[model samples]
Target chain A: MNTLKINYKNIYYPPGGILMWIIIFLELITFGMALVAFVYYGNEQRELFHHSRMQLNTTFGAINTVFLLTSGFFMANAVHQFKEKEIQKSSVFFKLAMLGGFLFLGLKSIEYYHKIESGISLDTNMFYTFYWLLTGFHVIHVIMGLVILGWTNYGMTKKDSDTITEDVEACAAFWHMCDLIWLLLFPVLYLIF
Target chain B: MQKSLIFVYGVLIALTIATALIANFMLVSPFVVSLIMGLAVFKFSLVTFQFMELKKANSFWKVSLTLTLGLIVLLIIFLK
Candidate 1:
């Protein structure tokens, strides 16, 4: 019988999957602060806060949700491919996931452009402040995920497959974090009042 | 396993669209809307647990990660 080695301490250590745990922890802290700001500001101007929500395109938010979810699926498939020792197949999925991230940014840019044209700038009011701050932070993470995905694909082409699996795994984890954070953000920022 | 997960993925996407439409179009109470939105969170958790196989991971890690996410949600609720 072949026995798999298990190390308990490794489960909670840095550079292990616990790196994701740390990143997630930081994200939760920042998002929590943002929520507090939103509530505080919303209370100061309740009508404007709700009215700003009415201007947002729920359709755009819905489409972005679909895009991020699909990207998460591709990232999962990429990890599966790596587990199967199909390096090229895994790289393809990583690139596809990055493409999804790019598509999301494009949609978001369009949404912002329309908002600006309609005179709903970030300086418009407190709600717009939260809208821009939360979603803008989210877009930064999306771009970072895409950059990580691109670098992972490049590393796959340049290095031995076994040498890069850990990095690829880390990048996939980050990309999925990006997706998961958006899942939370979409409901709070776009769906709810 | 992967194919079935993909099917579940499709169902999740459909649920998001359905929930968004209901939230936007219906005249439901905020409490009822939150209930529906909570259902979406359940479906999302199902995908992460079943499709992503997080349930099969080391139990300690999964539990800690879940606790962290719960804390985030609790903070959001703190505002209301």
Candidate 2:
């Protein structure tokens, strides 16, 4: 008689582990609630929201979306390479992912500069308030993700590298969270009123 | 696996472009808004299931995330 063996880790722990999944869930819920509120207020002041949204550059938003998505793809590839034991290739992909993050920040900074030059701030209006708060928080997340990726890449470079699969998976998960949040934010803030 | 990843990425980019075109060129209507939101949800799912490897995860995570996204989209549409 053959007994089936179960890998409990596969059953309970996700790609990045249980703890990271918890963080992702909480973050998603928080952002979802904020988006719902933004929509509610948008309905209340339709014209203001429309006008405020018009102040945004859709091209920049679209480009940024591409940036994050590309970065996410690269990060996924990095994890794949790492799992395949191609550490050098994984590091290259990691760098590419970081490049995407940097491009996103660069474009976002330009957009922010334009807004600040035009005297737009968190208190500018309800729409701008949501804009700043939501996107600003997201930018912070991207920055944190980049730092995590950078550290993970550095670890990969050491002769006796101690970077484990779980650590790399956690980093990728966090980076993808940034991508996921931006995916939600880009449309509501840029395309929709 | 790499081919599959590439396919997913292609689909995502195409969807993103379609969304932009619809929003920029088409007249604003209930249908248009719904379409854009729907596309956004589709893109989100691709990233979550494919890039984030949620497809390999347990059913609980998959179901809960799907429900969470659905709820968020419904609330936005209802409120809007």
Find the candidate with the highest lDDT and give its number.
2
lDDT by residue (B1-80, candidate 1, tens digit) is 27966886788788887878777787645574465457546665755565455655567766766776666665555454
RMSD of 1: 3.2
Ten contiguous residues with the weakest lDDT in model 2 chain B? B27-36
lDDT of 1 at A148: 77
TM-score of structure candidate 2: 0.96
Candidate 2 residue lDDT tens string, A102-190 = 99999999999999999999999999999999999999999999999999999987999988777888899999999889988998999
Instruction: List the DockQ of the predictions in order.
Output: 0.40, 0.66
Q: Estimate the overall C-alpha local distance difference test score of candidate 1.
A: 0.72
Q: What interface RMSD, in Å and to 1 decimal, does model 1 have? A: 3.8
Chain B TM-score, one value per candidate, order as shown: 0.66, 0.96
Candidate 1: list runs displaced more than 4 Å.
A1-10, A13-16, A159-162, B50-53, B75-78
